[model samples]
Target: MIELKREGDVFVLRMDAGENRFHPDFLAAANEALTEVERAEGPKALVTTGAGKFYSNGLDLEWLGAHQEEFVPYLESVNALYARFLELPAPTVAAVNGHAFAGGAMLALAQDFAVMRTDRGYFCLPEVDLGMSFTPGMSALIQGRLTAPVAHEAMLTGRRYAAEQAREAGIVQRTADEAGVLPAAVELAASLAGKDGGTVRAIRVGLYKHVIAALRGPALPE
Candidate 1:
């Protein structure tokens, strides 16, 4: 289950389901929560985190296996979700409380900044190992967010980066103890909460136009 609550000037979106995979229902809940965040008035920012030992495990492969026919549309929705985050009016932060793999890593990449847990967890994109290739939008998001060398290394090697490693690679902006992840992320979000939402949106939309177009366009390359 996902929960959305306000903490001072920040909205915390907590993904509490085990593994927090992208099941259809999970996507629906996330979208609804983001809608509420978008509609809120005045100074605000957002922080996304997960419970237990997982930020998210990415797509629900078992669910996908049972619903193969829906693959295209499902991916389209996933792409749209990434686009939404890119265009979200408020500044956003990802509190990587634990492991973030594949799509989960992309979700964190969507944020303006990320704070990862220091002693545990990893940031990895293991699509190659899983014999899967990224959807077009996913590729765009990753490449857009990361430096050329880092993106190439991460996508090609499927390396598992610990918090400090990820920070050095520029995958996460900060690292904190497990217990401090959320607090640090919230503090970061709150610090940027006073920026005008519309201006933030405008700048992001303008700066990431190509990335947003790729995200909002086709999930797969034509």
Candidate 2:
């Protein structure tokens, strides 16, 4: 299950896998929590993390392999979440306290920034390896935020990377100690809280839109 809690100026969204790797009810709860976070007008920032050990181990291979019909709606649902992150007005940060796999990694990357635990886990995108492809929105996000070579590597390899490596690749801003990952993420978000919220949002929207303009094909930069 996922939980959303207000922490003064920020909100914490956590992923709890329990014993099941992929739980449909859990996913639905998480998505709903995200929506509520979006609607929380006064919260200055968002901190997304996971409980216990893993940030997320991507999809639950067993659950997914067993309940085939669930995949469609799940993927569709996550795509919608990706869109919400893209349009979110508040500054957001991911606290990758543990490993993030496939969709989990995508959710973390969708945040405006990230603080990751250097030794606890890693990041990977294995959708293609799992016989699926990342949504187009994910493609746009990677292309815009990550260097071509790095993005290409993740897409091609479907391998996980350590936090230090992710930081070097330009995905994570900093690597945190295991004990402080979420706290550090919240710290960064808090720093952004005092800025001109409207201005910050305008910049993100304008910047990504301009970036996609060229991605449409390629005209000379105006």
- What would the TM-scores of all predictions be? 0.99, 0.83
Q: Write the per-residue lDDT of candidate 1 for residues 1-222, one digit (tens) a residue.
A: 999999889999999999999999999999999999999999999999999999998898889999999988898888888899989999999999999999999999988999999999999999989999998789988999899999999999999999999999999999999899999999999999999998999998898888889888877788
Per-residue lDDT of model 2, residues 81-145, tens digit only: 65566566788899998878776787787789999898678788887687876555567766777
lDDT of model number 2: 0.74
User: Among these predicted structures, which one has the highest lDDT?
Assistant: 1
lDDT score for residue 94 of model 1: 99
All models: lDDT? Answer: 0.94, 0.74
The predictions' CA RMSDs to the true structure, in order, are: 0.6, 5.1
The positional error of residue 45 in candidate 2, measured at the CA in angstroms, is: 0.3
| Model 2 CA deviation exceeding 4 Å by range | 19-22, 60-63, 209-222
TM-score, cand. 1 vs. native: 0.99
